[model samples]
Target: MAATKKGNTEQIHDLLYQALETEIGGVGVYTTALTCAVNDDLRKEWQGYLDETKTHKQVLLTVFEELGLDPAAAVPSRKIVKHHADGLVAAMEMAKKGGDPSAAQIVAGECVVLAETKDHQNWELIGLVADKLSGAEAATLKKAYEAVEKDEDHHLYHTMGWTRELWIEALGFPAVLPPPEEVKKVETAIGASRAEHARDDMLKHPR
Candidate 1:
């Protein structure tokens, strides 16, 4: 879409809200998973990741301010993050429930899928925005988006790959797919949270 300066600003505003939702959802998942992780290393991996996502949130909010919005008052709004996080949590739960290598592998596969999907989604959104945005502003947002997307790609290709192999070695195959209803529940909860949070962020960062 050809964007006028005003249209570009509005589009970016909408995207920032989406980004906020994602950051919160990611943070929530990491915090929750930290409570149940069996390995110190896994806990560390996610902990560091949460910090990265938090940084992304701050940068995007700042970008909003540069665009002339009151960023501190603005809420971040990436609802998809919750759904993605829920998938990871469900995988962890699956590992505990079956106590079998195959089940664990299956769960790990799910995590890989989630991570990969996140990488693609964020890259595309930010890249598109970069294309539409001008000069230093576009460069700023694209670089930030690339950083987070790269982290997710690493998790998908490395952490999740090892996890899947471990499952194959133990169970010969994956054990289960997440139930649709469970996913639906998470979507509803996170989506509601996103709406409320977006309103809060806008209030804090007013246009």
Candidate 2:
């Protein structure tokens, strides 16, 4: 029984380490995306996300310390996450080197949304598994999840909005300036879906 519990704790620690690495990558993604952003609004938004991502990395490190896990631990999952992030970074750099600034901005938006997709799911799964933990361990995971979940949601949904809108504009379709999510202050799954659909319809109708 003790061995089984130890194995489980090790698994959780591994996952947390991966998540910490992902957050570190998220900061890089946001920083690069901010540089590619052509619109002032989008640049400001990415900057805010970059700040949040930095804080998230620190928060994960705190969780590792709380669990007596080594924050410097190298794991396969972290390597995978790092590889994906590096690919995105390289893609952004490629786009930037080209002459079309608008296209580069669109590329950056897409890359950010892709990285945030994984980053968001990581936290959501952590939140779910946190229920299986007990005592101070559970408390630590739950606190970290609560602290960062909303920011993760904003990062994914907001960047998805930016990606779609930028692509629409690039294709000569009318795009939402700030996106409905921003205007409506969407914070829930239902709200995000509604905002997304509404933005799509607006693009299709194009008044």
Candidate 3:
């Protein structure tokens, strides 16, 4: 039983470390993405997300301090996370240099979606881990998870909505700008799906 508990604790530590790395990388992704954003609405939205991402990083730093972990400790998984983030930034830079603002915007949205996917999953797992534990550890993780959960959902789902609508517009369809997710303020997977399905009606009604 002791061995099992130790293993689980180690796993949680690794997760927290990876989560911190994700937020750090997320800041970079959002920052570079803003440079590629052509739509004023999208630019404003991404700027907000960028600020939130930075705050999320600080949240994790606090978590690390509370849990007695080194936020800067060397971890193997951190390298892979950084590599993926750097790739996303590089992809956006390539698109931006292609001299097509619209195309670059699309690429940026895709990168944001990718980065937020991992980030959202990290928080979800943290919440799950918190549920299984008790005492101060659970309390700390739960607080951190709750603080960041809604933002993570919004980051992933809304960016996905934006990416899809951007692609549809690029395909020359009558795509809805700002996406239904944004207008409806979706913060869950189900809400995002509903918003996506409502797009046809939105285009028809144009509210």
Candidate 4:
């Protein structure tokens, strides 16, 4: 069977749907990560992100309504995104089954970072789409992007720090707990660079 072609609006709708599901999975991922996290500060941070991810889904739902897109409609691409999330969940479970609690925590951290990497890029692309739109559609997507962009940034950046620091310790290398700077809260390019520098400085005196 020939595949149905999609218009620009249809494409955007599918992308939004994909992003919506990813955010939904994000909440679960963060919740699971918190369960395995031994670091109090990291656990606290994941808890906050889990909350933000929930709100992000609501924001996307509102955007769907504004665009007259049905949130319940199934899209193939979204199924792929969901499967990826499922894979992450299974990996965490496998780690736990092995009785390696620390490995499980690291796996969860890595999964959150992976999920957020896609989530962050999705919003950035949506921002570009918003710039090309007009009137209410533009307003709706732009608002949604602005509302979640910073949180998404924090999820990707901060969790990435946790993943790295955790791995460093796992490898018997001196690692900084709670990384010198909270990279997750960083939303700007310059902020990311600063966080990198902070990590470098901390690595010199790992606890």
Candidate 5:
């Protein structure tokens, strides 16, 4: 039993370390993404997300303090996480340098979606881990998860909607700008799907 518990705790520590690195990479991703954003609304939205990503980093730092982990400790998984993040940033940069603002915007959206996918999954796992833990550890993780959960959902789902709509528009369809997901403020997978399905109606009604 003791061995099992130690293994679980070690695994949780690795996750937290990766989560911290994800947020750090997220900040860079959003910052670069903003440069590629042509739509005023998308730019505004990403700016907000950038600020929130910064806050999420701070949240993880606090979690490390409470859990007696080193926020800056060298972890093997963290190096891989940073590599992925840096690659995302580089992709956006390459797209931006291609000299097509619209194409770059789409590429940026794709990168954001990829980064947010990881971010959302990390928080989801954290929530699950928190449910299994008890005492101070559980409380700390729960607070961190709760604080960032909604934002992670919004970041992933809404960006997905944006990326899909942008692709539709690029394909020369009459795509709805800002997407139904943004207008409806979707925060769940189901809600995002529903909003996406309703896009035809949104284009027709144009509210």
Candidate 6:
């Protein structure tokens, strides 16, 4: 385990190295967004942001290279990983013990919804931060991540709308679910019903 930890330290060095690379990679995503953007306002805004991210990548990469770290090393934080694994196990165990498939489904749905909400909120927060930025640090984050602001907004808007459509389609329930027992049975039967519909929707529309 000590040896693994040592290796992870080495890997950690690599991951930071790769994190800079990831920043470098982000430029392309931003640039693509800039090119594909139809709105002039977005084009300039996205391009400005990509340019900033590219500069950030270059600066950090130079610093990493100066520090003698391998530019492509991997880093692992065992503690954090173990904690996450434990949390997942505990959550699953709780769900299983509760024996409520509707709750499980709701949990899954909320995770997705919460993640999307966070992404949307991040844009507003970042944009607010950008308003207060100045000098090199400000320029670095704003210009580089500028596209990110737009991307974040786009992501939240499009995903929220798409998920809303999907949510409505998937769950047009009249109001309350059936009793828990029936809910569990129906949840268990979802896959079977989907398959039946695929086999013949007309025959199973009300099934």
lDDT to native, each model: 0.55, 0.85, 0.94, 0.83, 0.94, 0.41
Q: Mind giving the per-residue lDDT tens digits that candidate 1 earns over 1-207?
A: 464742566656666666655565566655555555444555565567667767766766766676666644444344455566667767667675776544554454456446545644665687787776778878777777665665554444434433433444456553111221112222233443443334434435544
TM-score of 1: 0.57
Q: Which tens-of-lDDT digit does each residue in 80-124 have in candidate 4?
A: 988988888887778778888888889988888899989998999
TM-score, candidate number 3: 0.97
Tell me the lDDT of model 2 at 143: 97
lDDT of residue 26 for candidate 6: 47
Q: Cα RMSD for candidate 4?
A: 4.2
- Indicate the worst ten consecutive residues by lDDT in candidate 2: 2-11
**Alpha-carbon lDDT of model 1:** 0.55
TM-score of 4: 0.90
Model 3 Cα shift for residue 75 (angstroms): 0.5
lDDT of 3 by residue, 1-207 (tens): 765543488779999999999999999999999999989999999999999999999999999999999999999999999999999999999999999999999999999999999999999999988887878999999999999999999999999999999999999999988999999999999999999999999999998
| Candidate 5 residue-wise lDDT, 128-191, digit = tens | 8888777889899999999999999999999999899999999999988898999999999999
Model 3, backbone clash pairs (residues 3+ apart or across chains), number: 0
Judging by TM-score, tell me the better candidate of 4 and 5.
Answer: 5
Once model 2 is optimally superposed onto the true structure by TM-score, how far is the C-alpha of residue 50 displaced, in angstroms? 0.2
Runs of candidate 6 with Cα error greater than 4 angstroms are 1-110, 172-207
Candidate 3 CA-lDDT value: 0.94
